[model samples]
Target: MEESDALRAARAVRRSVLGDAYVDGQSADPDPAGREFQDYITSTAWGVWARGGALASRDRSLLVLAMTAALGRMEEFRVHAGSALRAGVTDEEIDELLFQIAAYCGVPAGVAARRVVRAVRAERGEA
Candidate 1:
């Protein structure tokens, strides 16, 4: 299949934010349906990420962290949290964001996000 310019741009944005290693791992061998889904996400979701309008990539990363955490998507939360950190979001900022999440999304969500953040930090040798 020919890749559209949008898909190519989105894939580059995804690699920049999520890291080449992670993107490469995700692109490694998939069944037909899975490959289609991956392409869909790369073109759509990552396309939004690639469009830098009012929000910068770091802002988008932080927003993703909050939204994923509030939705109890811990794995996604962890991924975005790591990306947020790499995008120049401070540990203190993430800590404060957790407090905000606790206040708005409930304490459980905040706690779960903290756990994910801790694991991500540990993985990066930050903890």
Candidate 2:
């Protein structure tokens, strides 16, 4: 099937944020359930919403990390934390955001997010 406009746009934006290797890894041989989910989130969450705003990708990346962290979505927090780093949101910025998260979202959530951020940073050899 030909790619939909949304899918194409999503592919571009997703690549820009997550990088080619990660996106390609997720796109490989997805199960039916996974395919459906990938399609929907790519088309809607990324293609539509992530691309719709005036905020730069860097800003969006930071917001995504913070929101995922506050919700204790560890997998998503890790993914977006990596993306935020790639998008040029510094470790210092993320550290400061963790403090904000602790103030409102609770210390446990901030701690959990910090763990993910650390792992991601380690994976990328960023300290």
Candidate 3:
């Protein structure tokens, strides 16, 4: 399939933030619908939010994590939190972010965010 400019840019940004292994894994799913959904995100979420504007990838990643936590979206939180690390956010910063969420967005949300953060940290051998 021919890749659009947006898809190309998004893929670059996504890989930079999530690593080539994770990005390739996303593309490895054999289902057409899954591939299509990934493509759509490449053209939208990563293409626009991740690749555009003045916000550095690290800052954008942190913001995305905070937003996902505030909205109680654990799955998205997991993805972005992992990506945040790849995007150069440190564990301490993530901790601060979750603490901020607990203070403002509520304890449950912060707790949920912590679970995902720990899982990702463990995956990276930071446990």
* lDDT (10s digit) by residue, model 3, range 1-127: 3587768888888888878888899899899889988898787888765456788878888888988899999998998887776788888999999899999899999999999999988998988
Deviation in angstroms for 12 in model 2? 0.7
Clashes of each: 0, 0, 0
TM-score of every candidate relative to the true structure: 0.92, 0.87, 0.87
Q: TM-score-based ranking, best first?
A: 1, 3, 2
* For every candidate, C-alpha RMSD to the true structure in Å: 1.3, 2.0, 1.9
Error of 1 at 2 (Å): 3.8
Instruction: Give per-residue CA lDDT, model 1, range 1-127, as digits (tens).
Output: 3598889899998998889888988888568777787899898889997776898887887888888888999988877888886677889989999999999999999999999888888998987
lDDT of each: 0.86, 0.81, 0.85
Single out the weakest 10-residue window by summed lDDT for candidate 1.
Answer: 28-37
Worst 10 residues of 2 by lDDT: 44-53
Top-TM-score candidate index = 1
The pairs that clash in candidate 2 are none
